[model samples]
Target: MRKLIIGITGASGACYGIRALQMLREIEDVQTHLVISPSGMRTALEEGTGLSGEDIRALADVCHHHKDIGASIASGSFRADGMLVAPCSIKTLSGIAHCYADDLMTRAADVCLKERRRVVLMVRETPLHAGHITLMDQATRSGAIIMPPVPGFYTQPKTIEDLVTQTVGRALDLFDIDHPSVRRWKKECATEA
Candidate 1:
């Protein structure tokens, strides 16, 4: 079984993380360990997902509290395949970039980076200033993939859910987890006029 750790932060797009869990559930071989920052839960509520913290926790195979620094996922020896921080807030990104590991979410990401595992951070901030760019650069230098939730127009997305699914699907692609929902780019064949 492939074990993946997932973190949800207080960023605006809570749906990305929730959709990730929902999609991962369809893949039987993938076991998910979820950690939600306190702000993440509040944001989820505010974003109107209608899912309480318990409801969200129920989606994961294992749920770790953000404050639980002792969680299995916080250790490099735990052997998780990798981690994904969907809707990764700037605060969380800063923590991961600096190796601050103050909470389980950042700690697990730190462990993943130290272990040379794939750590995809779906940073959700727009109108980013230079400092945010610098933090992203720092995190990349430390071996984290900074993937902003930018939707692909080529997919011809018609709904917000479509855009979210595409982004989440691409993020999962980094872990080599295939989901039927992701639409791949194809070269168009030119016909003779």
Candidate 2:
């Protein structure tokens, strides 16, 4: 079974994280370990997911508190395949970039990096300054894939949910997990005229 650590930060796009969880639940082989920052919870409420903290937690196989620094996932020995910080806040990115490991989310990311495991950060901010770029560079240098949740228009999404599914599906693809919602690109071929 592949174990995946999912982190939901306080960034604006909480839907990415939520959709990731919902989609992962469909795959029988993947076990999801979820950790949502306090600000993450607040943002989910502010963004009107219409689901309480309990409702969100119910989506995961296991849920860890953000303050639990000593959780199983915080250690490098834990055999998690990788981690995805959907809608990663700049603060979380800085922590991961600097190896601060102050909380479970960043600490787990640090552990994954130290173990040379795949780490993807979906940074959500826009109009970024040099500092954000620097942080992204540092995280990338440390073996984390910085993936911002930019929608692909080729899918011709008709709803906000469709866009969210496509972005989340791409993130899962990095982990080698195939999500049925992902609309893969297929080139059109023309016959000889």
Candidate 3:
């Protein structure tokens, strides 16, 4: 089984994380372990996922408390394929870059880095400053992929859902997890019959 660790932080784009979990649940062989920060839960409510944090937790195969630094995922021996922090907050990004494992999400990411496993952070910040740039640089040096969810309009998305799913799909692609929602760029658009 492929083990995937998903972290959700307090960011505006909670929908990305929610949609990712919904897609992951459809795959039979993937075992998803989830950890959500308290602020993340609040953002889910504020952003109106229409699903409570508990409801979201139900989507995962296993859910860990944000404060549980002793969780299995915090250790390098947990044997996960990779970690993804979708809609990652800048605060969480800074913490992960600095190896500040004050919470399970950061701790798990740190472990992934130490284990040489892929750690993709879908950072959800805009109008970034020099400090954010430095943190991203530091994180990249530490083996983290900083993926901001920038939309590709070339996909000809007609709805906001299209954009969100496309971003989430691309994030899953980083881990090589196949999602049906992605609309890959083609050399030419298919013509009507």
Backbone clashes in each candidate structure, one number apiece? 0, 0, 0
Count clashing pairs, candidate 2: 0
Q: Put down candidate 2 lDDT per residue, 1-193, tens digits, no spaces.
A: 9999999999999899999999999999999999999999999989999989999999999999999998999998999999999989999999999999999999999999999999999999999999999999999999999999999999999999999999999999999999988999999997989
Instruction: Name the lDDT value of residue 142 in candidate 3.
Output: 98
CA lDDT for candidate 2: 0.96
| lDDT of model 3, residue 46 | 94
Flag regions of model 3 displaced more than 4 Å: 189-193
Best of the two (2, 3) by lDDT: 2
Candidate numbers, best lDDT first, in rank order: 2, 1, 3
- Model 1 clash tally, residue pairs: 0
In model 1, residue pairs whose N, Cα or C atoms come closer than 3 Å (at least 3 residues apart or on different chains), thus clashing, are none
Once model 3 is optimally superposed onto the true structure by TM-score, how far is the C-alpha of residue 117 displaced, in angstroms?
A: 0.6
The better candidate by TM-score, 2 or 3, is 2
Model 3 lDDT per residue over 50-92, tens place: 9987799998999999999899999988999999998899999
